[model samples]
Target: MSSKTVKLLLVGIGGYGHFYIDGIEALADQVELVAIVDPFPAQALDWPTLQAQDIPCFDTLDAFLATGITVDLAVLASPISFHADQSCALMEAGVHVLCEKPIAATIPEVERMREVRDSTGKFLEIGYQWSFSEAVQNLKTDILSGHYGMAQCLSTHVAWPRTSAYYARNSWAGKIHNAQGAPVYDSPVANATAHFLHNMLFVLGETQQSSALPRKIRAECYRVNPIENYDTACLEVETEKGDRILFYTTHAADANDGPSFLYRFEGAEIRYEIGGDIVAYLADGSIKNYGNPEGTHMRKLDVCVAKVLDADGATTPICSIEAASSHTYCVNALQQIPVYTVDPAYLQVKEIKPGEQLTFIPNMGVHLREAFEQQKLFSEMNFPWATPMGAAVVVCPIHS
Candidate 1:
C-alpha cells in the first residue's frame, strides 16, 4: 500500500467511465490518478481535465503495464468481454481491482479469474454498487447475525424500458458474445437490472465474504427486440438449503418501475423500492430501516480506497469476487434455456422521432408484476403468451 496516497489506474474512459471520473475527482485528495487505460480517452474525459491532471493515456493495458507504473488500485469500467483478462492481468501486476459487474460472462472465465486472484493475493471487488452501500451491508450483517432467523423466500422485480438508442449505444449491449468470441451474456439480468438480482443472492450468503450458490435454477427468456439475447427474463433459483429466490426483469416493457423486493424471513418481512427506504418489519411489531442503497453515488469506490488505506488489514471490499460469481453462475445457467421471441401481436413501436423509436409489449408490466408478487413464473400464471421453463433446471457448480 502507498503510505501517503493511493496510486490509481482508470480504465475505459467512455460510457460508465463518466461516473468513475466524478468519483475520482471527489476523492482526489486521498488518491492520485496514475494512468488512464483507454483506446480513445477523450470520449468521456475532457481535454482540459486531462491536460490539467497531466495523465498519460494508453491504447491498451499491455502498453500501460509496459511502463512499469506502480498502481495500488485499478478501477475497471471496461466492457464485459475484457473483464476476465483485464482483471487477472491487473491483479497479477500487483494491483487491487474494482471491476464492474456480472463478474464475467461465463463460469469458466469466472473460475479462471478466481484462480488468478488467489494466486496473486490481490483483492478483486466486482462493481455491484448497491452491495457496497451501507444500507445493504447492514442488511447483510443482520441476515448473517440470524436476527432475521431463516430466509423463507425472496422476490425482486425491475422493469426498466430501453429504446433502440440504448441497445444501439454500444456494440455489445444485447449480445451473448462479443465479436472476439468472448462471452458477454449481455441482457437485462446480466447488465441493467443485475444489481437487484445479485442483491437477493448476496444478502443470503452464508458468510460475510461469500454468497450462497444456486443449487438449482429454472428460467424462461423472451425477446421482443431484435437482439442476440433476451430482453426479458423470469427465473427461480433455489439455494442448497431449498429456499426460493425469484427474479423478474425486463427492458422491453412500457413501464419503468422497481428494483423493489419482498424478502420473507421466519422472523420478519423485508421490503424496499428504489429511491426509498428499506424496511424490515418483524412479527414482534418491531421495524428496522436500512436507509436506501442509492443514497450514495460511487460509494463503492470510496470504500475500496478506505480499505486500501486503513490500518485494519482485515477490512475488505464488501462485495468480493466470490460473492459476485453467483450472479455469473445464474447467468451461465440461464444460457441453457432457449430464448423465445414474443409474438408481434403484443408488440408496438412508438417512434419518438426520426431515427429513434421505443418498442414495448402492451400490458407487459401487469403480467410481470403478477408473476413477481406471486413468486411465480409467467407460465405458472397461465399467460397465453408465456412458455413453461419445462424442467430446464440447471445447478450452479460449487467450485469447492
Candidate 2:
C-alpha cells in the first residue's frame, strides 16, 4: 500500500521557515511541500528551486489559500505578533496548523486561537521543537518509567549575547509593541529563553498535566541595553507538584558562551551541555554521554512531523496543542512581567567609553535583512541573531 502524502503550505520563509523546509526534506517520503508564502519578495530567492520541484510560491497567505493548493497542513513561521491571526486564519480555512512558538502574544489571543481551532476541528500544534530532542525523549521515557521516582528540581541557563547592532537592524527589533499590546512582540523569554523553559516542561512531563500549574513565580529582569526590553532574567517557579524550576537567560554575554539545559531528580542528574552533548549520572556511579555534535535544531521538527504522521486519533507527544500551550503560557507570562524598563532616548544614542572594545549588535533588523538576502537562512542559522557580539552590562544603579 502506498503511504498518504500530507501536503504542506509554509508561511514566512525567513528564519524558522528554513527549519521547516529542512524538516520537510527529512520526511519527504511522508510529506510534501506544496506551497509557500512570504511577504518580502526578495526573501523568496529559493522559490524557483521549490517551484521546479513542484512547489508553488506566493507573496501573501490569502493568495496561497485561494490557489486551491490542497494542502493538509499549514506551517506558520511569521513573527510573534502574527501567530494568533495567521493560525486562526489557516485553521478557519480548514487547514491544520503547526505554528512557531509563543503561541500568541497574550493569553486572550491564545484562548481565541483555541476556540477557533476547536470550532473548526482543525488541529493546532504550536512548535516547541525542543521537545523532540533525543536526550529529551530519553529523559521523558525515564521519568515516565519511574526510574527517577519523582522529579524534584529542574534548572536551566540560556545565557547568550546580543550586540547593539542586533537591536538597531530593524524598526521592531526590540520594541514593546507592534502596534499591538502583545508583550511578546520583542522580548527575551518569548523569543529566546522559551526553548529552555519548554524543554524543562517536556522533560518533566508537565506539558499535558494540568495538576502542575506554576503556583509561585518570582523573577528579576535586567535591561542593560537602551532598548525597551529586558536583556537578562532569572526566575524561580514552584509548581503545584512541588517541582521547582530555575531559569536564567541573557541577551548580553560573551560570544563563545553557548546555551545549556540541566535537570536534577532525586538520585539522578541529566545535563544537555553546550554544543549538543547530553551527559547523565545515576546514583550508582553510572555516567553516560549522548553526543550529537553535528545535529541541527531542524531535526526536532522532523521528529515531530514523523510522530504526528504515525500517531492515531490523539495528538502525538511532540505535536500536541496542549503541550505546546503549556510552554506558551509560561513564556508569555515571563515576557508579560514588567520586570525592567529602559529609556527610549538611551536606545537612540550610541554609548561609548574609552578602552572599551567595539562589539556588533545582533539587531533583528539586521537578521531580517540577512534573511531577506539569504532565502535559506533558518531559525538555527549561526547568524548574529543568536550570537550577539556585545557585553550586556546592567546600568541601573538605583533600586526601588
Candidate 3:
C-alpha cells in the first residue's frame, strides 16, 4: 500500500471538513483527493480550487460509492446522526474511515460500526484530536506503565461560550435528534467540548486504542438557551474499574475558558490548563511536563493517513470505535436522564456579536470551576437551579 499514493474520499467539507482540506495540503505528496461527498459542496471554502483541479463532488456517500472509484480512506466530517451509517457503508465498500468524534449517539450504531470494521478488517479511527496528539499518547503510556500508580479520579472543566449563530450554523448543532428521528444528542459534551470528556476516558483506557467502560452516570443536565439539548452538563461517571470521572462543560458559560483537567493518581497528580502544558506533580517533588495537546489538532489526519497507507512505523493504533464508544455510552445515558430548564432568575441573554445573541448563566464559569476543583457536580454544590438526576446506568455487553 505504501508503494502508491493513497486515495482519499472526503465526506462533508461544509464545516469541520475544512480541517481535512487543510491537512491534505500538508500531506499533498502522500495522498490523492479522489472525490468529495457533501450535500452542499460549493459551500466549502475550497470548492472553487477543488473544482478547477477536476475533483468531482457527489451529493451523498452512496453516489460516490456507486461511481466505483476506489478510495483508501474516507474522512467523515458529517453530522452525528450520519456517522455510523456512513462509516459502515464506507468500510463495507473496502475503505478505511477517520470519523469525527463521539462515534455515534446510540450504542447500537457504535456496535454496528465496530462489527463492520472488524469484519472488513479496516481501521475506523475516531478523530478525537487530543487522542491523536503526542501529549495524550504520552500520558496514556505513563498510566499504563503504572508510573502514576492507580488512577484515583479524573476531572475536566470546559467553558466555551457559543452564541445563537453557532447553533444556527447547522441543522444538527444543538439538536437532540435529527429531522429523521435518528439520535443526534448534540450538546456541549457530545459535540463542541467532547475532546475533554473523551480525554478523561481515553487516558484511563486499558489499551492505547480503548477507553474505560463507564458503568454508571450521575448527572445534572441544564440549559439556559432554548436549544433542544442541554448546553451545560455535569457528569460523574463510574468506570468498570470503579474509578471516578467527573466532566463539566457549558456553552452557556459567561466566559471563554478553553479546557482544564486534573487527573489524580496515587503517585502523582496530572494537570493541564488551557494555554499551558500537561504537567504531572509527583510525590517525589519532581515535575514532568507533556507538551500541550491543542497544537496537534491536524495530526489526526496524519495519524489516520499513516495507518491507511501502512507506512513504515506508522501502523499506529489510533482511537478505535470501541474506545470512542465509552463517550457515546455516557452520552446516551445522559439522554435518559432529564434536563432541567434553567429558571429565568439565574439566566441572562446577551448579544455578544451583532446577529449573534447568546443565553448564558451569569458567572457560570466560576460556579463550575468551583465544582471541578472539588470534583463535584453542580447539584452537589447546591446550585439552586440545578436538579439532580438519578444514576443513569448503561449496559455494555461487549465490555461488561
**Residue 74 error for model 2, in Å?**
1.3
State, as a TM-score between 0 and 1, how close model 1 is to the true structure: 0.95
**Candidate 2 C-alpha lDDT tens digits along 187-304:** 6666766777766666666533211355555565556576776676656666656687766666654443435555777778877667767777888899867554226566545544
lDDT of each candidate versus the true structure: 0.86, 0.62, 0.86
In terms of lDDT, the poorest run of 10 residues in model 3 is 389-398
Alpha-carbon RMSD, each predicted model: 2.0, 9.7, 2.1
- Model 3: per-residue Cα lDDT over 1-400, one tens digit each: 5667889999888788887898998899999999999998788898888889999899988888889999988999999999999999998998888999878888899989978988988788889999888999998999999999998999999999998988888877789988888889999989999989899999999998789988888787887888899999888888999999999899987678759989999999999989899999999999999999988888989888877677453434578875798888888788877788888888888987788888888888898899999877787788777765533444434454
Clashing pairs in 3: none
TM-score of each: 0.95, 0.76, 0.95
Candidate 3: where are CA atoms >4 Å away? 1-3, 311-316, 388-400
| Positional deviation of residue 172's Cα in model 1 after best superposition, in angstroms | 1.5
Instruction: State in Å the error of residue 147, model 1.
Output: 1.2
Predicted candidate 3: what Cα RMSD to the true structure?
2.1
